[model samples]
Target: MFDINGGELIVLFVVAALVIGPQRLPAYAEQLAVLVRRGREWISQARTRLDEETGDLGVDWEALDPRKYDPRRIVRDALLDEPSTARRAAASAVVGIPPAASAPLVGPAPYDDEAT
Candidate 1:
């Protein structure tokens, strides 16, 4: 997320080495690693507690992902029932209209530049 490259990492290491000195750098690094591990553990515990409190109910944990959690997926899934989606597709097929042509445009068409 920070977009740190090899050169940036080298620079960071050099600066840390200078500031903390070679003898103490390893100790500091160890402490930092421990803190990061603890933080991750705390976050996982909190998520577990929240999930327990909510009782999951009918929610599918298999489909749930912490890294890619999206609230909209729940709403979209609720709206687009499998049978209704199939019925809509079948109705559209009977009308001989391509599904892509029925979708709404979010903005002006790309070819508008050429037209102008």
Candidate 2:
């Protein structure tokens, strides 16, 4: 997340080594690792607590998941409700793209061995 490249990491290491000194660098590095681990644990605990509190209020956690923003899911949900012809025609007027002649089939097509 910090986006530190190899060169940046080397620079950070050199600075830490110079400032902290070679004699104590390993000990300091170990301490830093432990601090980071503890911080992560605290964050996870906070997230769990928040989720539990929100769950009491009946939130749908799956909908909050960022990975669920799949294009297929979005388009499928939008198409499930059949809009009237007037709405469909007006939609293109706002966006300036021609409406489809017809909606495409939502799922897998029938096998066509003849095409293969």
Candidate 3:
């Protein structure tokens, strides 16, 4: 995230040395390294925990990404598309049948007036 070039880094080191004094600059630098290492470790652990928690959810990354959005295409697909593979799998599961044995829905659904 930082845009520090070689020159800028050298300038920062010089300033730190001047303010903190060269006598203890090495000690301070080592402390800073330890702090940075700890921050990285914390972030890594957090990411690992988050991954473990959400790995089973099967997130649909592309569907939520605004960069690939096309309003017209989205509307068109929603209006005209047949059930997708995921939808079919879900339907099959709801019916307690294996997907391979589940038949595609044909024609209009039957109505049971008494059930309603």
Looking at model 1, the pairs that clash are none
Model 1 scores worst on lDDT over the 10 consecutive residues at 100-109
lDDT of 1 at 39: 100
Model 2 vs truth, CA RMSD: 10.6
Candidate 1 lands at a TM-score of: 0.46
TM-score of each: 0.46, 0.47, 0.56
| Every candidate's lDDT | 0.79, 0.83, 0.88
lDDT of 1 at 41: 100
Of models 2 and 3, which has the larger TM-score?
3
Runs with alpha carbons beyond 4 Å of true place in candidate 3? 1-13, 82-116
Task: Please give, for residues 1-116, the per-residue lDDT of candidate 1 as tens digits.
Answer: 99999999999989989999989988999999999999999999999999899885997776776867787987777555444555656766888867665444455446755664
Query: Which candidate leads the pack in TM-score?
Result: 3
Worst 10 residues of 3 by lDDT: 101-110
The model with the greatest lDDT is 3
